[model samples]
Target chain A: MKIGIFFCLKVWNMNAKIAIQGIKGSFHHQVAQEYYYQNVEVDECLSFEELIDSLMSGKSDQAVMAIENSIAGPIIPNYALIDKNNLHIIGEHYLDIHQNFMALKGQKIEDILEVHSHPMALLQCMEFLKKYPNIKLVEDKDTAETARRIHQNQLKGIAAIASKTASEMYDLVILAPEIQTINNNMTRFVIINKADNFVSKNEINRASIKFELDHKRGSLAAVLNVMSDCKLNLTKIQSLPKIETPWKYSFFVDVTFEKYEDYAKAKALLTIMAEYFKVLGEYKNTKP
Target chain B: MKIGIFFCLKVWNMNAKIAIQGIKGSFHHQVAQEYYYQNVEVDECLSFEELIDSLMSGKSDQAVMAIENSIAGPIIPNYALIDKNNLHIIGEHYLDIHQNFMALKGQKIEDILEVHSHPMALLQCMEFLKKYPNIKLVEDKDTAETARRIHQNQLKGIAAIASKTASEMYDLVILAPEIQTINNNMTRFVIINKADNFVSKNEINRASIKFELDHKRGSLAAVLNVMSDCKLNLTKIQSLPKIETPWKYSFFVDVTFEKYEDYAKAKALLTIMAEYFKVLGEYKNTKP
Candidate 1:
């Protein structure tokens, strides 16, 4: 009977429509495929705002958004978007980002005169690109989209810093592989959905939370102390200025705990301590 | 005698060569000019890395770089750049950013087919641009450079979102004024110089610091408690992952205080409590 119930749950999740921030062969698309065990429908979005819209409007059952990268750090605007839209992060996946230099199959590295990619991709691969001072670097909207455009337009003397998947999908040859400045490039993507989606309590060991504190001395420290006393491990903390109220900030944190009771205890205490508090998500710890 | 000393100081500062990340009319240029009262040589660099090279090689006496914007939050990589270079921040300036839409005199807003600017500028003015759905939004290297290009090429039906100074320098007419989503947009810039240039103790009230805490529970909280006890106001806090060590983080914080002794006390305490500590800058608090 237990096996039958688990099979049913998996079958139900198989039909989820996942919204992503870019077209096929993009990192978002890659995450969607690797994260779900079964085949899922993908609703391609050209931007994060559109991805949120698709989820909110019921066009897609869930969304995958890149929240942070090891090198580039957090994507602040996306945090605001998830908070403002009341979206919940159900899970997260870390992708080993390998930026490859690709162009038309017949072209060599020396033939490239210009390289196009997303600004972050260009920044990550700056050390390698610096060796060729003569090549002009152009910023584009997407990494894979640039590769697709190059192939479709039959462009010459142009290269793209993208993923190996993009090269295969676009029928281009990768001139150089894993050209990022740091070999250990990783991007953390969060799986998000509407607030109503529920996960089993026993499966949750991590949470994303946001809160605001009063202008008291060591107010943040006090809240953090509460988290520590409850045996919660603070993995990440980011403070974003409340735009309307210049100096005031709202803190977003990710924490993991061995017991749900400990998180519950901390939540109760934080609710009383903070002027405003909200749980952005409760999910299984990807790292733990 | 006092007036004569002041006049000599001003004359000495007049010949100082300043390095900025973009050409004249960019926001960096605006800060460079407004921060100094007299004429100074400007060494334009296309990238932040180049800007650092100019400063390190003694090609420029000082450098001006934007640290944070009210709308977009912090520029993380720049923080790493400043910390890694061992540069000193002698002063700071707050520029009220006004993104104006400009084009050739004859073209109307409806006549423009494409708008080009830095990605951050485009994001700041996104609310205004959404109305013109027909116009293509293109990201370029620099806002002022895009305006100059449109002027130099006499490109018809092209608009650029840049500073008011850019319009005047490139002879472009403003199609719309103050087009940023927020009317009170502000960007904080830091004036950096070699470590040997020092500001008097009485003039210093703010500091930018970087430190790393051990893995002990409540280590961060303990450090914050020390800062609070020393009467320091934590204006900003950002955590950057130590790239080499996956889970460990190095914190960058900005603090302000009423007395220099309080800051010194906190620095001493943090030095003892943290595994590693460094002061990125000691300058007057621009906001305070």
Candidate 2:
């Protein structure tokens, strides 16, 4: 009995508590399950703000936050959240999104009066939903939560756009499969923690950074030149306006390189060139 | 009678039909009222897609579209919509956003059980709403529409976060004024027409352009160099992923200049520097 108790304690310690922005069977939940090998205890949050609070308060070991989607572009607020909270991204995962329309087992597509889902999910499946002009599209907080609600309430004449996992989990049937308009739908999620530089230097190949340039002409151009000279390949560049400084902007950039030394050299140069510079994260490149 | 009929026809021809997303009390409607000096007729649309259809089908003379917000960032899909539909932006307007929480007359703030509004409006007023933990926040299609519904239905416990115009138009009483977290909240709107170059050459000081660069290192830097060398001030830059070719991006840029000739010169140089370049619009600078 003593040995068994010790074994159970060790196993519990091995299980990671991962924070996600939705309930079970959500895309965020799916990411948490697929990205980690060990057993994960999910800390479900209704909003991104709540998810950050969970991480900040030490309720969870780490978090999996969706950063951007191929069809929807970046979730800009998440970037600001991560930056403001000083969270470090340790890794990333790209998930193929397949939005499925699900409802009660007895209902056909014609029987549904309303469809509820996350706004982004609803936007993605617009082409499919447009055919059923009579059905009202309502925005909900989460995709899987809606499926769960339909199941728990035994609601009729209502449907949800969610994942296949959600249908299986909530005992719902898929009315339409792969309903997203775009075939190449993908969402990139970042695994973030409170600590920085968690990954070994040699294994790191990508970095996310933010910088501000002066009002001089071609200042941005000059910075990009320095990045090019350092042999960094710019993967993504997004400019967010500084609200306090009306027209001024700060650029959030992602770069990937083959060598750590090259990234380091570029970082050193950028620190000197930019009026404000901060490294949000350095992680292994997930791209093949 | 014949003279009156001819005069009525002439007067009707002079009334410009402006297409806007949302109903009469929406920010778009306010823009329509403020931006044009002519006798204007408003064509209301529920969605941006519907607004585009109205403009494309010639149901309206031109459209007013919100492109970006000070706090919420750019409405990126609008850029893609404009680019894909080949619509030209002929003018711009800036509106100060003031979100107000309103409810049925005689109801105190404590009496409100739910709040309905556009997601953007809800987000902007989060700090104020956070204090009302018992109130449920629901997302709707438009802010003013919710206010209208609350009034029409006599919803005693329901409130809405909308503009002051909405409250006055719907006869609701404001419970909380200026609930947005930021004081300098503003939204930038663009006046789009089907025809290109509606503004004359001498008056044009700003332009919106899109370009794609080769995969070569420093190619973007090289293009920016041309703009800077030609004396153009880069105001905004947003990169949209090319869905067909994953990992590649197309940059949408806005630039303002002192002289139309300087803008013209930079446009020529950017055309030569970029692999693919297109001028999305050329209009007078609205910024002071």
Candidate 3:
């Protein structure tokens, strides 16, 4: 009880600033805004791995990593760092990934001969890219930088796959508004911090854990059955291979328990789970 | 019997062609070679997400996602995709991420006033960047692409951060070889597919799992204890917040164990891991 109280006090003293990857106006920047609010400062990094490193090294108090998106799916490279760094997920942020094909003012859509953006941005605009065959597709470092590139170069024949913020920042006109091929394009961001930070009240519906199962056949089935038999609703499931194994994976699962009772039951079922696997952590989620 | 024969006959038919995100000679390209070998055909996508989509659509038999580098640490964005994708990890690849500082054929390192590359490439060459503080740092997309960009634009007094392959590909001169700030930098890649195609090898020694907890105190300790009791060594651990909850995490773990007895013990411990969490999956590593 003392430790818990001390931990909360420690949290209260923290600046709680959330670090985000990308320059200002990047999607991660917005997600950090959603969490850090007026009092928090959003720290920027050139790469996602550095963002986590900054947090792990005491440079920042927290971080938000783009996990998965509606059209593109998850960010796979981030998983390696999240694994390498011991940062814990404290919250989740779902941001609307609104993309725009922006170009310099007075540059007509027909004037565009190339589209540049972060790979995902270009891909989200793939269907649009197909429509304009002459517009060669290229990738920039980030969505915001894409706009910055066109503006700095004063390139008339180039457009950028970027966000509304990026367009506004670079004074670029939107040739194609919401050019993302999918209307449902959304990126889920996971806010991470040192393992000792507060889990937060917002985490009631969230849980996180890790485990390993035997290599034999039916081992995976037995592991999944633990969730199904307990009647827990699984929202997401993904597995990554260990560096030492062949054709085996360690799985990550997100489960939605309609009631607290189900959550309790699911936790209880982990006892049987540990019999066949290795449990990592079961922690609550916080929304930002 | 039929299933066993079907499995037996399927052994020789498994020809996995993996897609990776990069141009011809990025670190990811090298890693793909580690897994699929010279016989394998590599399909290059511009983005990591596209590689995942390629696997999703069966456009590529498998996809290789760079997870982390030893000296550079984790590639955190890839972790998000791993959590978001339905693809299973069937293998692992490690590539040395060596960086070369390059420029136009006639240019000397002393003559260079600007450096360009993907931001991460720049970061990997941070020490190099620092040494030439007067030089402007320009961010391009990929290391190889950056080299290509330098060649295409014919920028004066400029250098690029890329691999030896980029120098060879673009016919540029390596102004400074092995200029990465981190000399020991090595990247780990995961070859993912829709199917769990493992031809059992007795030497596989590691596994991975993801899980969520019941939002209780001591949950992490409870799970860690399981690994400790079973003597499983954890090489990596990452926690991402569960979106459904405002402040909870789903933890991913990479644990090391040897042989049948150890694998069984690890699984047994994971079964009980649920007193507070959910069990995700146990995986075998395929890194050669």
Give the share of true interchain contacts found in each model: 0.45, 0.54, 0.02
Lowest summed lDDT over 10 consecutive residues: which window, candidate 2 chain A? A1-10
**Predicted structure with the largest DockQ when compared to the true one:** 1
Which is the better candidate, 1 or 2, if ranked by TM-score? 1
TM-score of chain B of 2: 0.93
Q: Could you give the DockQ of candidate 1? A: 0.62
* Candidate 1 TM-score for chain A: 0.94
Error of 2 at B124 (Å): 1.4
Error of 3 at B183 (Å): 2.3
Model 1 scores a TM of 0.95
Model 2 docking category: medium
- Point out where model 2 deviates above 4 Å: A1-12, B1-12, B37-39
Candidates ranked, most accurate by TM-score first: 1, 2, 3
Docking class of 3: incorrect
**TM-score per candidate:** 0.95, 0.94, 0.59
**Candidate 1: what lDDT?**
0.86
* DockQ, all models: 0.62, 0.61, 0.07
